[model samples]
Target: MIPGMFDYFAPSTLEEATRLLEQHGPDAKLLAGGHSLIPLMKLRLAAPRVLVDLNGVAGLAGIEERDGHLRIGAMTRHAQLEASELISDRYPLIADAAAVIADPLVRNRGTIGGSLAHADPAGDLASVMTALRAELVVVGPRRERTIPIDDFLVGLFTTALEPNEVLSEVRVPSPNGGSGGAYVKLERKVGDFATVAIAVQLTVRDGTCDEAGIALTSVGPTNLRARQAEDSLRGGSLDEQSLRAAADLAAQEAQPAADLRGSEEYKRDMVRVLTLRALRRALERATR
Candidate 1:
């Protein structure tokens, strides 16, 4: 179905876009890559009276290195992220997750900010960002604010962003010493949404886990940081026994729901299995 009729405004700058949103209020929607929003609009779930296209906005599409973090423009496409040498070298988990989002066609058009703003529980980027503890920069009529990834996602298809705010960039801290990360998902088919997804980041020192971050997706109302699992690994050697115990805690902490993709029980099981596999792979990479 076609989207409802709406006034289209392509703004050349973020200030203009935010002004449009302020003017239109709840009746306005910001259009980025439109991979996610357009579908909702076409389905009539979202019928904004005005579409503030951000494509024309300058300075919203690039990857840059700052003092100690990689700052990705909100409009940066998944395909771009996959192709970024910086990301591949320092944040391989992000690159891996980007490569697995839908198919090539979707990745070519989908924006990272769009994905995070949409806050889809099944989205790969959300879980990866959660595990990475990424920061989101948002601008609004009042002022600009930085939101932690954990606080940014409030619920399924929901976020902490105010209606008049636009997500400007995502900031990922550079990987610490001896750190490696990986994302693993169990999909029914290629390019399908994950039935269960896991992201693991480990900082190992002398064969002992100095730090660990774990997140699970598509198994809860929101992407969940596996705090219990991470806590289990910290200060311990990632031996087979400890890994198994952490995996069990990860599964226990999951709050999956019964859905068409899989039952909650099955999803919980996948969380356990995938968490173990991802952690093992991440550990191997860190060692190497």
Candidate 2:
């Protein structure tokens, strides 16, 4: 089905976009890549009165390094991220996740800011952001604020963003020495959302784990941080026994729902399997 009739406003500046949003309030929606919003609109799940397009807005589509963090403009396309030398060198996990989102056509059009703003629980990029402990920079009528990844996702298809707020950029810390990350997902087919996915980042020192971040998607109402599992790995060697124990803890922590993708039990089991695999791969890379 086609989306319902709506007024379009292409704002060349953020001030103009914010004014449009303030004018329309809840009746206005910001259009980025439109990969997520357009589908929802076509399905009649979202029917805004006006679309404030941000494509014409300058200075919202680049990747840069600032203050020890990788700052990505909200309008940066997935395809751009996939080809970014800085991203591949400093944040390979993000490049891996971006490369797997849908296909070439979708990646060429989908924007990182749009994906995070949409806050789909099963999205691979969301899980990676959670594992990387990224921060989101948002601009609203009143002022600009930063929200951590842990606090950004509120629930399925929900976020901390207020109706009039817009995401401007995402800030991810560059991986330090002895740090490595990986993302693993099990999908029924190419371009499908994960049935169960795991993203792991580990920092090691002298063969012992210093810090670990584990995040799971498509297994809960929101992207889940496996805090218990991460704590289990800290201060321990990345051995077979420790890895298995952490994987078990992660699987137990998952609160997956029974859905068409798979049964809750099946998803929980896959989480165990994927967690172990991701951890092993991350550890190997860190050591190398």
Clashing pairs in 2: none
20-132: candidate 2 lDDT, tens digit per residue:
89989999999999999999999999999899999999999999998989899999999999999988777777887888888889999999999998888888888898888
lDDT of 1 by residue, 98-127 (tens): 988999989999999999999998999999
TM-score of each: 0.98, 0.97
Question: Candidate 2, residue 115: CA error in Å?
Answer: 0.6
Candidate 1 has a TM-score of 0.98
Instruction: Give me the runs in candidate 1 sitting further than 4 Å from their true place.
Output: none
Task: Give lDDT for model 2.
Answer: 0.91
Where in model 2 is the C-alpha error above 4 Å?
none
Candidate 1, residue 65: lDDT? 85
